[model samples]
Target: MSTEMISITSYCLKYDIEGSFIDSLEDGGLIEIVWVNNERFIPYSVLPQLERYIRWHYELDINPEGIETIQYLLYKIDLLKQEAADLRSRLKVYEGTK
Candidate 1:
């Protein structure tokens, strides 16, 4: 797997977000920061989540606690979806055996 990371400074400049906001996310355990070569970086794998967080903060004016709640809800929704899919597949297998 390719491990790509983006510098926090560049991300903040590009996204027009305050560095302190990113720091808050990290402090809140919503996102992680990787320190490499004395530079702070965020994994590229989390870009999608980071973008959503940016939208929540800037466009929706969501606070850190709200963001955390949304994240938890989204995670639960994903788990439910996966469980539903697994049940459907199992049902298909049972139907075939019937």
Candidate 2:
């Protein structure tokens, strides 16, 4: 595995979280786990996302299904924001021609 990865076990132990939470995240497709020499590790690139999910789970008391729903809604909101920005840019172009 890459040196930029953190061991999942170590992370769980440090945070006092259960390993099954990571398993739930993996099953929910929220994060990818790499197996190196029979150990599970997560790349640094995904650490932020994992932390976000952890907060939602532990702090906000959200389950995996709730997290999945929140993720989907956030994705849709981002898409809508992008679409609005694109439309505004096109409108500006039209106004500039007038």
Candidate 3:
């Protein structure tokens, strides 16, 4: 609906990738495909992530299941990093009180 979406067909044509790759990503829950007026699109926000997955698939020859696992691990790692940063901030506040 917004201008921030790219048509899946145009993207595939521009990048020379298979449409089924996008379908597989959607099936693996790694990304969301938005359909409007009988056309499929992907939000620009997920382009970087989608490109990473594409690389993993095309360059590294990773499968959809493997991509799913990697995505899960990356998510966990981000959460842990955020948690660690919060803990550090609290620790700094406590240190300043002493």
Candidate 4:
């Protein structure tokens, strides 16, 4: 529940012995990011951005500032869902009483 969200696109990355970032496919997948929100497959084209995220965040463990937003977001979503369910139950009770 305390997972983080990150954004790292502008930073540079090095790939292969040549030292240039591999901005194309055909080599290793140029993207890797796993998050609570990204539970499913995001668009394939966005992989490079995900790759940058993995390199800078996961492998390096260097999460950006304010990355705790995900945790807060998830927490609020969960709370709202529960609250909605409770309201529905109360609504049913009031309807029956009426």
Is 1 or 4 the stronger prediction by TM-score? 1
Lowest lDDT 10-residue stretch of candidate 2: 1-10
Ranking by TM-score: 2, 3, 1, 4
Runs with alpha carbons beyond 4 Å of true place in candidate 2: 1-3
| lDDT, candidate 1, at 12 | 90
For residue 63, what is the lDDT in candidate 1? 86
Whole-model lDDT per candidate: 0.91, 0.93, 0.95, 0.46
Clash pairs, candidate 1, are none
In lDDT terms, how accurate is model 2? 0.93
Q: After superposition, how far is residue 75 of candidate 1 from its true place, in Å?
A: 0.8
In Å, residue 42's CA in model 1 sits off its true spot by 1.7
- Model 4 misplaced stretches (Cα beyond 4 Å): 1-62
Segments of candidate 3 deviating more than 4 angstroms: 93-98
Q: List the residue pairs that clash in candidate 2.
A: none
TM-score comparison, 2 vs 4, better candidate: 2
Q: Could you tell me every candidate's TM-score relative to the true structure?
A: 0.80, 0.93, 0.82, 0.36
lDDT of 2 by residue, 13-58 (tens): 8999989999998998989999999999989899999999999999
The candidates, ranked best first by lDDT, are: 3, 2, 1, 4
lDDT of 3 at 77: 100
Question: Model 1 off-target regions past 4 Å?
Answer: 96-98
Cα lDDT tens digits, model 4, 1-98, are 34333322322222221112322221344434333443422344565554554455446654433223443566799999999999999999999998
Clashes of each: 0, 0, 0, 1
Worst 10 residues of 1 by lDDT: 44-53
